[model samples]
Target: MSQLSETTDGHLLKAITDACDGRIIQMPGPMAVTGVYPERSPPFKTIKLKGIEEFLLASARIGNRQPIILKLTPMDAVDYEAIEIESNKITQFEALEKHLVDHLGGYFNLLLGEAGADGLDAPYIASGHSLNAAITIFRREVEPLLARIKATRLAKAEQAAALAYADNDDWGTW
Candidate 1:
């Protein structure tokens, strides 16, 4: 445990180092959208997602380790909602992508296109705040394993090709 390490934060540091084996990465999440969306200019949209405490402490070798990523969203309310849908709609992590293509896709379409044009007709969600959790997954440890697999496969193929060439040369005269 190195003191004054940049990666070392309070609880997150102890959580990562005090354990018996493996590596850990921990960071805070941005939980609020503080910017304003002006009308008649850029498309008006903002988002607030939750944070997750991830662990990659699998004791297996680099070839067998499985990285773990997890998050815990707070149970809080929101400041605004669509005029048509309920005001208190809470969002969740339905997909494991880099963006919110699943959670806010439909609402965004309505807000920027038809809903605004049709004179504010809300559907599933109307004007209310909601809490949501966000998560992104990665496997830096397993990547080496994958590379080893590919290398093994390629070597086998090359060996077979060499054997075939040798057999042809030896049998050509017979």
Candidate 2:
């Protein structure tokens, strides 16, 4: 059984890296984002992680043109009720969300320019090939990995709940 402790940052990082076949590299410095690119050439198949307010922006550059952008939030992948913390659980969740957002902020600033950075809520204008290889990779690779992580967390939470309520006599027959 995977414990809640398995969701640590290192574990998550390892999972992501392994999922990408080590194509995902940790960004240097204090940024919270990671880089995804091909093993041979970069900027040809590059994906940058950025934060826009409560969302994470995945900007992928397939060629020398602009990027294909996708926005997502932790809620898009994680279930609030499925995860808990030893301390205030809500606060911990909020912190993790904020951490991811903040981590992406620096990269977002670089991708969208200063004006766009200030107005993160504004809709992004992606001007490149739509439904291309980058988006395909995101859909096939990233999204499923996130769903799997969420499923793992949800399963652990459900098991814990069942154990906790196993001895309870409050409920009548369904």
Candidate 3:
């Protein structure tokens, strides 16, 4: 591998670890509550490690690859819930986008809006692409990959639930 690729991998690894640990950093944008943007009086965000790492490992085409846009679908909070519902929760994809913009701030920009048909909540520059082209590629490529990632996430969640609550039929004495 080239030195540049190695360096990038190292950096990405660090970001992934930080995100997994739930250490999030906020970026500068819309700090006013004008009935606009998702979060009022600015934005609150984090990184989505699982979905992102999986994407880099699986999708990203190496060799002369410029950064592509990384638009993320709003996460489903209750899709894999095994306990009481979390009324306020964002998905891993949302977190991953935030991480990208924070850690790689110079290379990306975060745009917040309602997640429409594509379920895209946060859109950030993964590389350098025009808006139209980015949207086209995202619709054609990233969306499908995200669906797969979500499926895997759900499966993993189910496994976690089984591990945590399996064969526990009686709650007798603390």
Report clash pairs, candidate 2: 51-104
lDDT of 3 at 112: 16
Best by TM-score: 3
Q: Give Cα-based local distance difference scores for all models.
A: 0.29, 0.32, 0.32
> Which 10 consecutive positions of candidate 2 have the poorest summed lDDT?
81-90
Cα lDDT tens digits, model 1, 1-174, are: 354221212212232223314333222454433222334254334555444433333221111122111221212333322111111121332222212223333333333342133335422322222212211111122222334444666788999987777768665534
lDDT comparison, 1 vs 3, better candidate: 3
Sort all candidates by TM-score, best to worst: 3, 1, 2
State each model's C-alpha RMSD to the native.
21.7, 20.3, 20.4
Please rank every candidate by lDDT, starting with the best: 3, 2, 1
Give the distance in Å from residue 43's predicted Cα in candidate 1 to where it truly belongs: 9.8
Off by over 4 Å in 3: 1-126, 166-174
Give one digit per residue, the lDDT tens place, for model 2 in 16-66: 222222121221222232223234343122223243213332222112232
**Cα lDDT tens digits for candidate 3, 81-157:** 11110101212234544443344332212111211223355445454443333334433443334445446667888
Native-vs-model 1 lDDT?
0.29
Compared to the true structure, candidate 2 yields what TM-score?
0.21
